[model samples]
Target chain A: MSSGEIKALVFDVFGTVVDWRTSISRQAAEFGAKHGVTADWDKFADDWRAGYGAGMAKVNSGEDEWKIVDQIHRERLEVILDEYGFPNINDDELTEFNKAWHRLDGWPDATTGLTRLKSKFIISSLSNGNIALLTNMAKYANLPWDAVLSAELAGKYKRHPRAYTKTAELLGLEYDEVMLVAAHNDDLRGAIKAGLKAALVTRPDEFGDAKKPDLEPDPDFNYFAKDFHDLADQLGCD
Target chain B: MSSGEIKALVFDVFGTVVDWRTSISRQAAEFGAKHGVTADWDKFADDWRAGYGAGMAKVNSGEDEWKIVDQIHRERLEVILDEYGFPNINDDELTEFNKAWHRLDGWPDATTGLTRLKSKFIISSLSNGNIALLTNMAKYANLPWDAVLSAELAGKYKRHPRAYTKTAELLGLEYDEVMLVAAHNDDLRGAIKAGLKAALVTRPDEFGDAKKPDLEPDPDFNYFAKDFHDLADQLGCD
Candidate 1:
């Protein structure tokens, strides 16, 4: 694929750009320690993320009213805090603690790789995360994004065609002119179905041994790279 | 007014940071010259911009369906093109020409003042323009926006309470914590009425001799300055 045709690279932030599992687990473990609680933090992270799909599914299916990701996370947190056997926490404390998702750490290659890509293409987070979460994460992790985009803007979640197409439309580009770079084949498939180009960048440690990473791309994916730098190289980005 | 209370400074972009009147007039003049058509370019700019408020008002009032600023501009462009008696232009040419709004020139202090303000606050466009128009304008004019926000995301236009409130909501801020910085009192009044703080920054030459600019702030406004730099100074931005 010619690099000249690409106008923007919309990234799936949770896994592809940041080590969300590790970051969330570490923060959750710290919060647990402060409350004299202990459990498998990785499992905690996974459980928290597990709530994401169901919450978004309800909204996408029109079963639930439209809500921001922060609200969705907070609702899920209320359930998980009870399941994890945490003592009663005040609303203020819970609200602050729930912001752990806003402080995720970028992958080792994320900042540098995105910087390189930004030099050529407009780089943005196209996660299901709300605008505030992605914006705070960009600041916290020093991710240089030309813009911060999210499925929240579309009032839908990823895997929904509107999530992919709305992002392209927002950027004033033809669907194929924007490329979706993600660590998951499902997301790539969604982008492809929405008429956007797709590139898979494998993040082997994304699930922290609790889940299998999609280490290989489908035959139809335009490019696959082990890291952002590798992906930049493959895309011929300067 | 305490500067510390303002977490984000949302701007009215068209005639505030960008010299839209001059920029549009120049481009239109060039296009007219090429097409062998001659008319008052300043009047042309005013006519084009006059359509913007009416277009947005229709959306705000639910009298018309939601449409992006690009579509609004194109709709006006079609009417103005006929008024100027220009030769028939094809869709491709008209589309490219309609993007003139996306190539506005920044006021002399716009970039520097915004850069200073950005060091202290999240500075973003909160215009009736769509994200694509704002993003392209930022890239073209070198405006340093932390985010490109617009009424397009809110599904309403400015002066409507939802437009101001939704921007703050998306930024995860209380309405009072977000300040609207603009060249017009009417826009500032709308923001203040929506519970946001308002800062009026004068753009004396925004309309040249065609119309009088709102060079002074309404007495109820929280802050007033001669230009963006003056606003930055008043806000204590470095």
Candidate 2:
């Protein structure tokens, strides 16, 4: 009911806590230059991310076998590399580059804001990203998570109730005791539908200037704020 | 083959990171005084821990349903409490007392040593303890873990190959790239048998004066040290 009842804040990491678009675009541009190629890296970032939803959909629909986000991202990266006019990159180089997702930078307010929230509640990542990606990004970006949880643990991706429910089970908390703090309204709605509380922390720049951000929360959402700092403030976290 | 090859250091928490024996004994003594009951609290702690291995063996052997370590601990606590002649405890009090495991203090070298190790290697809790137990303990004791991994994730307890192999898989690292740093020789041997490198970091007083400690490492272990600090130095962590 109230934000005070929330024992934990499980975050959606990719576009919510970290600016995956900008980070991926920057890395893609550098990779392009190294191969003497040029293209819209922003579009490339979008295209790369486009595969994510579709990839998860296939698994959730039972049309494909269970595969982790890292594998999905790698599969997409291989296809995109060939399309972007790159030479045949060796397996080692591809493997290293595939970890660009692991090197993502958190939004400016992420570290300090999460620290403030951590003082008042157990904070963790509930991203669809695999544990390795979330773990590496936490270290790389200085994101202070008490635990790095993933849909990988549930053997399903988000929007699937199992992912949300399994996380609560793992943390030994009731569904309503955990709140999903995410920038995307869809993710928050998924949490609400799955019996967990929802907080929409807007990142208007999450999709960059081209796409319209979900700036306002739906009426049913428990809390709406501008960013992690705003959410911490609203939750009465010092 | 060497500590140099290790990318991640997964720790065995119970006896290695925390002085659980003393912590549990102190808590038990306090609870007993409140209830007008008395016993050798040290023995109580030992008796409480005694159920852990056998309980896990049942689950690992498919003789019992899978349960987290917290549930396992609670079951043991209930049996011990009755034996200690305690009166009826309300559900809330029993729940609070069961969380004594969560409030454990890190060994003298744990926090500082883990921080130093975290500087160079990805460090995590690879305990048979459940996710909630490990996460709460990390926060309570100021253990700076990059992530928390557990046997609960694999639905098997330590010395089970699945537990060790799944941890490496979750981290996206080769088995040899992740080393198990444990106070127990058998756990280190489990890591080795599962293809991971092993570090025997002794806790000479882990079981207190009544029990023999694992003071020596098997020759096959990749590294050996007296405590976490010594282990950090041997592993070239600053």
Residue pairs with backbone atoms closer than 3 Å in model 2 (clashes)? none
Query: Tens-digit lDDT track for model 1 on A91-111?
Result: 989988899999999999988
- List native contact recovery per candidate, as a fraction of 1: 0.52, 0.81
Best by lDDT: 2
Q: Which candidate has the highest TM-score of all?
A: 2
Q: What is the lDDT of residue A194 in candidate 1?
A: 94
Q: Model 2, which residues run further than 4 Å from truth?
A: A1-4, B1-4
| Lowest lDDT 10-residue stretch of candidate 2 chain A | A1-10
- Expressed as tens digits, the lDDT of each residue in B88-158 for candidate 2 is 99988999899999989999999999999999999999999999999899899999999999999998999
Considering summed lDDT, which 10 consecutive residues are worst modelled in model 2 chain B? Answer: B1-10
Error of 2 at B108 (Å): 0.5
What C-alpha lDDT values do all the predictions have?
Answer: 0.90, 0.92
Instruction: Name model 1 segments beyond 4 Å from true.
Output: A1-4, B1-4
> For each candidate, what TM-score against the reference?
0.93, 0.98
What TM-score between 0 and 1 does chain B of candidate 2 receive? 0.97
Instruction: Kindly provide the TM-score of model 1 when superposed on the true structure, using C-alpha atoms.
Output: 0.93
